[model samples]
Target: MDLIDRVNEISKRIKTLGTTLQTEEATKNALIMPFIQALGYDVFNPIEVIPEFTTDHGVKKGEKVDYAVTKDNEIIMLFECKKFGAELSPGHASQLYRYFSVSEARFGVLTNGATYMFFTDLDKPNQMDAKPFFTLDMQKFEKQEIDELKKFTKPSFNLDEILNTASDLKYTNEVKKILNAEVENPSDDLVRFFTAKIYSGRLTQPVLEQFRLIVKRAHKQFITDKINERLETALAHPELSVKDNASPSVLLNEVSVELDNGVVTTEEEIEAYNIVKAILRTKAGASRIVMRDTKSYCGVLLDDNNRKPLCRFHFNAKQKYLGLMTDKVETRVPIESIDDIFEHADKLVETLNEYG
Candidate 1:
């Protein structure tokens, strides 16, 4: 299987057997070992993966790390594991940090069998960084994260290549955290920065508070507008839509239906599709919301499933109509213009919830 499939399988295992694990050893046996194996390492081979790997740190004797991964008889990476569900903090990586300075390994990993933190000597030579350059939470991860994780696999492991991007990844992760905090609750400095550019009046406590609320609202609306703009662009260019990955048979069926019914997808119908997609983007991803044009109406489906219809646009006549599927029934709501589709945004989301 591929890296994504293997990672997803491990995720399923964690959800199924996580509660039963109560100790670090059980966690290693059930979760961490599988993760190591998934990286194309031979866990059973002591030459490649040595358990209870020992080294001396300064005056300390026989300091043992959980596992030491070796390549060509040289220690390349060290792992320090904790019990499942245990909160991983910098304190937990103390052993890995010390081992990194003495050993030839350039990378250190601290994991609780669920969240894996990857550390390297980026800040100082032969010294592990206080914060990890990259982190992976198995419970929730994206494809891009999986791709990054692949770089550490046995066949693809490259010391120089990883170090090249480590600095940028570390800084980017920190910046995203700061941006998320500022977006939700703008800091005084952030508020002042915006206020100075937009307002010439002197800053006061009341004005600061007023601008705080304004900044928060403006930030939220700006994000919404950007999402809507992208959705509209994707609708205008159907080739850009991720939903075009449908199977050949499904594509053939749609084409045949359109041909038989003499379907002509108009600009108004496409606009209605865009509006409906933007409303349900939070509930269901934009890619899962599909537009299937037919002679009678333009159908918006969930995962391209006809039975799970989200809504439809009937713009072939003088009076436009929106067909909302609720309670397994199509309810035609009459409207004067395509913009009226926004009136039933809640109903569209509710329809999607019914499928769940």
Candidate 2:
């Protein structure tokens, strides 16, 4: 199978068996090793992928990393594994850090079998960076993230090529996070800076508050417009429209009805669904997590039926609420950010397993 198919299969396995991966060794055998296998590496072959690979050197003898990937007898990557559900921090990557110094490994990955963080010596030579340059949450894979991961797959692996762009990717990801925060809740400095560009105003408290509201509204409007444009592009294909050659019953209205253009799912709803999917992906496959939309609200169902509602998005107005249907009853919860869906993991899982 191709890389995308491989990832999808791994995703399904995580959902189907995540709870059972309670121990560190179990995590390695199930999640971590499968990831290595998906990366076009051979987990069965010790020549390429070494298990319990020792990075023992100097005073730190017998210190072993979970795995070491070698290319032509040259160590290329070192992996440090943790138990499933373990919180990953830089401190957890210390084993890989020490291994990077003694071995010729260029990349070090720290993972809890769910979250993988790729580290390299971008800041200084012979020392791994305190922060990872690339991070992938296996539960939430995107097209861009998949493209980034394709770079590390064995067939395309290149040390110099990755090094050349690692610095930029690291800085760009950080900048994106900052910009996301500013868009959601702009700071005083950011507000003033933008306000100065569009409005000639002093940094007074009342003026600052007014401009903040304007900026926030404008940003939301801009995002909404972009979403609409994309939706139009995806749904409104002229070729698919009824032409003069069509039968009288196959009119434009008929085609529109077939497309269900009237009951379009908004981008906000799609994002909310994706967030819910991300939260529950480790416990269920994508096929089982279905989203259905209507004019009133977007209903995300577990088995493509309303009786098995997973969550619902109510985004018909400025103030949006998420309906937690874990109890199969609409429990409205205020949602200001898309990240809030992650907070209901237990509820989602309980609801899903109960239905199953």
Whole-model Cα lDDT of every candidate shown, in order: 0.85, 0.80
Q: What is the C-alpha RMSD of each candidate to the true structure, in Å?
A: 15.8, 18.3
Give the residue spans of candidate 2 off by over 4 A. Answer: 236-356
- Writing each residue's lDDT as its tens digit, candidate 1 over 1-356 gives 66667899999999999999999999999999999999989999999999999988788888799999988788888999999989898788889989999889999999989999999988889989999989999998765577689788886678988999899999988996897799899999999999999999989999999999999999877766655554565587775442334333333334445447876777787788889989999887786787888767889987655557888888878887899997768999999888788889989989999977
Taking the tens digit of each residue's C-alpha lDDT, what string does model 2 give over 166-215?
99989988986887788889888988888899886567899999989888
Candidate 2 collision pairs: 15-282
Q: How many clashes does each candidate structure show, in the order listed?
A: 0, 1
Clashing pairs in 1: none
User: For model 2, what is the alpha-carbon lDDT of residue 242?
Assistant: 31
Q: Work out how many backbone clashes candidate 1 has.
A: 0
In candidate 1, what residue range of length 10 has the lowest lDDT sum? 242-251
Model 2: worst 10 consecutive residues (lDDT sum): 240-249
